[model samples]
Target: MNVDQIILQSVIAHRLDTIAQEMGAALERSSRSPIFAEACDFACGVCDHKGELVSQLNGIPILAAAGSFSVQAVLEKYTGNIQEGDVFIVNDPYRGGNHLPDIGIITPVFHQGELVFFTVSRAHHGDIGGSVAGSYNTRATEIFQEGIRIPPIKLAVKNSIIDEVLDLITYNTRNPQMLKSDLYAQIGANKIGQDRLRTLLDKYGLKKVKESIIQLLQQAEDLTKAEISKFPAGSYTGEEWLDDDGFQETPVKIKAEVTYEVNQVTIDFTGSDKQVTGFVNSSLVTTKSAAYIALLWTLSPEIPRNSGAFRPIKIIAPPGTVVNPAESAPVTLSTLHCASEIISAIFKACAKAVPEKIPAGFGRYCGPSFYGIDPRNQKFYVGFAFCCLGSGGGKKEQDGFPYMAPISNYGGVRAPNNEANEVQYPLLTLNHHLEVDTAGAGEYRGAPGIKYQVQFYGPDPSIVMFGDGMKIAPYGLGGGKEGSLNRNQLFTKESGNEWLKSKTAPRSLQPGDILTLFSSGGGGWGNPFKRNPQLVYEDYKNGYISRESALKEYGVVLTTKGIDWNETKKYRGIDYESRYNV
Candidate 1:
């Protein structure tokens, strides 16, 4: 293509991405739930008529369906019957969704009386009714117990809202008003995408606009392939494990074998273990999304995030494995647990292949779900107290960030404000801070872990501990050490401060009960002894690490007179204390 054509294509791509971002803005600003509004757990995208992902906003990477299975399900169910004003919804893991808690809303865009694009807004609702209030079911072995599974179905037709569908879904969840409002917010968000796409079509004409999109997809594919061609052509393997749900003797594994060709890569999960009785089983979409996320993170940022860009990467997720469970298997924990493992395993696999691009393992999700009646307004509340947010592993270029959520989304999800959470629910935040010496030590240290505590004063809310990254800590790369583990405890007069499982059913709580969470720290990158003594002293000075840790873990001696360079040099086994400009 000529310069003019390339310029036009770039403009069109920017507009498409902006449209998706506007949808997310609408969803977050207009939604009722803190999970969607404050934490930003949802993502928006635009797909082509053929259900191929065209453009997606950089939201939650875990929600990287990007019109793959989700859009295909809608097309297959309502292909010939789709109308301009129709809207579809789905949450069935087997059909297209990553799990039951994540509900996807699809809106078709018609231009010049032809199906041209579809807008999607996928969000994780706080309460999608299951056997319990919060959707994370620990003892669940079947899909039915996880939540109400909604297949691809019309939530709206011919621009008319279907009250029945809205009513049905809202009725199942505990907080109907919040769920209903959030659903409408999602629907409205998709409408923005549809409107934006139509406006773009009107301005550029459908023919030119569609042609530009096609060219953009091709350009993405070319750029991605070109980047992959630079990697060493060989097979590499890596694996990560999830904490057992007390039912198993050992942890669950999520492994990956990556094979790199001249211009393509393939990730195989054949050696992974079969589906377990726990809810951590991964759906195929979650597994594929993880593979795609891992590749996208390693690739050039200039590469557009669309389905075409991911064409060079193929995932062979064998059925019945933890990476790709069979139909009807419980997958409520897949997004947080096994999905994170999948990304880490791929990163580990490519450690030798692309050590510069690969970072160490990240601390997984340890947030617990709680639901109860708030005495403030006589309203029911459901929330995943995100104050228990963890850390991200270190990289060659940068240290991991503290208070990071799960590695699946890579902090696409935010930590809800403590003040806002307190006002929203009947809870009082006591403490939420980083603990000293909790970070994995290396040349680049991992983000430190958090110690969060909260007290509930509501009319007896029930809290369920449901997540991973406890039994096995985040693994480091390039000789870096592993990070810390997660721990949860419930303190009440009756229970007298008892420990809680990472995965379990909801337990009733009394008023004035306190909950404490110790989120895991991230893994490190490179050798710790090689780390700069100055940086170590700074960490010690800032109170991010203890003096003993700086001496023992990082081999840097510190005193009131600052670091003793000669002692540090002797400890690091290096001749010189040369300062390297980072």
Candidate 2:
């Protein structure tokens, strides 16, 4: 903590940040999937030799969480003397990694031939070997069907690729070139971090760097405890549901009970549903990461995420449950679906303890429904690019984001106009717009979802719609209203063909047949009766809500020109007592 120590620490921290940026740039430049380069679906980090996270890139949150487990896996497997050029790779959830697509590369940093720390990068590839075209199989029953599962293995030694390992990866994946290039990009990112660490050590010396790491850890631990001290020591429980497991078409529940003690918090998932025969089961590590997402967001949004930030928190999810599934359960889509419920549960728990800081429930899943077809013509044209719409936001001091990507707190980049699915694939664009009245209705209104219509341009083909948020309506908070449900269908204008009564459509889509996707909106905050009349009128003018529906949902009657204030007063009857149940 002396002046010289402070200066050395500052320089080392700066170098760590630079390493993260370099890793991100390498992935962005070399990755093939738009999900990685465009959406930034990747993460990189540095960890102590003991496998504790030291520094990480400001990349995707879930991907960043997996970095800790990846390091631990590599360290546990490598028992021999450390080397200057050893690198490891892992992508199996049972082995404490993320899904197969989120392949992680780890490289150990050495100074004077002594192991000091580890540099790691994880990127979500577009495809891993799976039963479906893309690794995202909506109907996958087991982990074996999802893709190749790589236990801790040495993918690279020093600066060269392990040819046998590379060959194994390429042989398993349908898109070998893309996966191979992205894998190398991750490896290269780690190398940049290694070089930067060496330079810092050479200048500041290894002892100072290690001492600075100790200080950083202490600071993070102190901040987490201070944040938790603000909340009263108590237990809070909340439950949310998934529309259905891939096998069954009925909603499954996930429950969380968070207990706050004197400087510590424990999130227990004992009441969650049993594992199902689908890809929605989550690993213990992924479940812990998802829980941390909500706790970190509420306690201290400004806090840096590393091992220390999690010192004051403990997460427990029983085996065989959706939140924390058994080792054998399929977890390919666990983070995509079950993780959302975990976030919602955390939000619900924090809202009870700190109502002002937490917002009401937002729309949970703005699904990127993945589909594809392989014909005799060219390379497989798969479709996993979907947009956000209709999910509600929490009622913070202000309104929540409409159709926003919740939990992960990310957004989708719209593809170019000419790049329609029909132009490239054997698909036709139908209806693509906002779905009206799909949002949760309340004093603070949740955002509404978007609608899209799809038709086949060629022969009958199969399409998979991996969707959620239908059965469990995004619940409202503190007197807020519940959001609307999701919908999907197959329509045909020629034969007056309309959608069949089904929650999800898994049938083959024939030529001349139409498919409609209805995204759900978020719920509203507070009682609708207290909503501002002028705001209701503005919504009518803005085409968000019709004049009649506004009067019905918000208790605000609108005149020909605008909202009728006097008539609204006549209809205003806020039943906050029953609505909030506080």
Candidate 3:
């Protein structure tokens, strides 16, 4: 290729990326729910006519890849019926979707009466009608109880809205107004993407545009392969476990064996447990998306996230397993819990090959859904809060960030503002602060978890807690200590505070009842004795760790005269058995 062609390819690639970003901005500006507008739990992508991802804007990593699968499903279902000004929507896990709440909207772009490209948007709806109020039925045993599942269907045909289809979807969800508004926002974003792509096509001509896309994809593939070749060829095994399947008291396992050979990687989940009776199962699309996210994080940050970037990666999770459950299995909580475990397992395997690139374990998942009726307005409200307790262990150079969401949803699901949340629901947030001494102990301590309290203001509110990392805290690596466990409790005026289970059964909270949540902390990395004493003193001064904990956990003695170097050295040298007298 000549210099002009190379320059043209770079310009076209930048244009495609800009189009994806514009779609995201449009969705954020038009969405009604705070989860979409404030939290930004949505993804926008531009694909080729063949449904292969070309460029995807920043959002949830899992949802970004899931959009490609959803577009492929639509293409397969509506082969020749696809035309200009037609839009299709899908949110069926059985049909290439991540879950029921993550709705996907796809639009086709035509130039000169020929299909040239496709634009897609996928967003998580706050509530879809289900057995539970927030659509996250932790106790659900079957997929039917999760929520309404919609297959690939044309939401708009020839620039005409399908009122019947729209009505059916909105009527089923608890928040009808928000649902309707968000759906339209998705449609508007798709239209914007379609127009932008068409303009580029017209300016560069079809042949030139198509050639540029091919060149971009090839460049991404080459870059990814070169990065993969840096890792030594070998197989590494790693395993992770959920607290339970929300049914039994026993732990559920998710195992993976990752193989790297000749610039290619394969992850096999042959030893993972079978599908459980609870709603923790993950669909095939979700499994693939989770694996892709882990692989993407492990590789160099410079690689472009296109279909070609995933060409050299393979994931094998047999059907009927927790990672790849059957159609009948419940999966409402898969993306939150199961997908997190999968990512952790892959990270553990990669650590064996590239320890410097992988940090210690982080908080797995935390989702607390609250719903009740407002006596003042005589209306029902469902509040879905995706809170993060803490981040993973520190890297070689820096400590991890606090209250970070799971790897798959980084920067996408933000904590809702306190004032906005109170105004939207019939509840009051008493406190949302970091818990002291909850971080794992190491040379560079992990981030501390958060502690929050909420009280009901109106009628009895039903609370459903879907979380993990209770019985077993986040694991540590390189001789670091494990993080603290999660705790959920309720304190009522009539009844004193009582501990609640991780996967608590739906129960109503009386007026003036307060619910307290202590999110789990991240695991630590490296040996604690190697930590700097000045940093430990700074942590104590900042109130992150109590004085007693600093002495016991870090062996740092503080007094009115400052550091007691002799006592500190003695404490640090004492073995665990000798110090504790076990």
Q: Give the winner by lDDT.
A: 1
TM-score for each prediction?
Answer: 0.98, 0.90, 0.95
lDDT, candidate 1, equals: 0.87
Q: Is candidate 2 or candidate 3 better by lDDT?
A: 3
Go through the candidates in order and give each one's C-alpha lDDT: 0.87, 0.73, 0.85
What is the clash count for each candidate, in the order shown?
Answer: 0, 14, 0
Candidate 3: lDDT over CA atoms? 0.85
Tens-digit lDDT track of model 2 for 207-256: 87888998887778888888888887899988878877767878788888
Better model by lDDT: candidate 1 vs candidate 2: 1
Models sorted by TM-score, best on top: 1, 3, 2
Instruction: Find the 10 residues in a row with the least total lDDT in model 3.
Output: 573-582
Candidate 1 on 1-582: residue-level lDDT in tens? 899988888899999989999999999999988998888999899999988899887888889544567999988888799987899999998898989989999998998889999899899999898898888888888899988999999999889889999899889888889888998999999988898898999998998899998998888899999988878889999877788754686988778899989889899988898888888898898888888888777777788878888889988988788878778988998888888888888888888778878887788788678888889899888888787888989999799998888888788988878999988989899989998888999888899999999999999899888888778999999988899999888899876989887886778999999999999899989999988888898899888899999999988889899987778878877765346432
Off by over 4 Å in 1: 577-582
| Residue pairs with backbone overlap in model 3 | none
What would the TM-score be for candidate 3 when compared with the true structure? 0.95
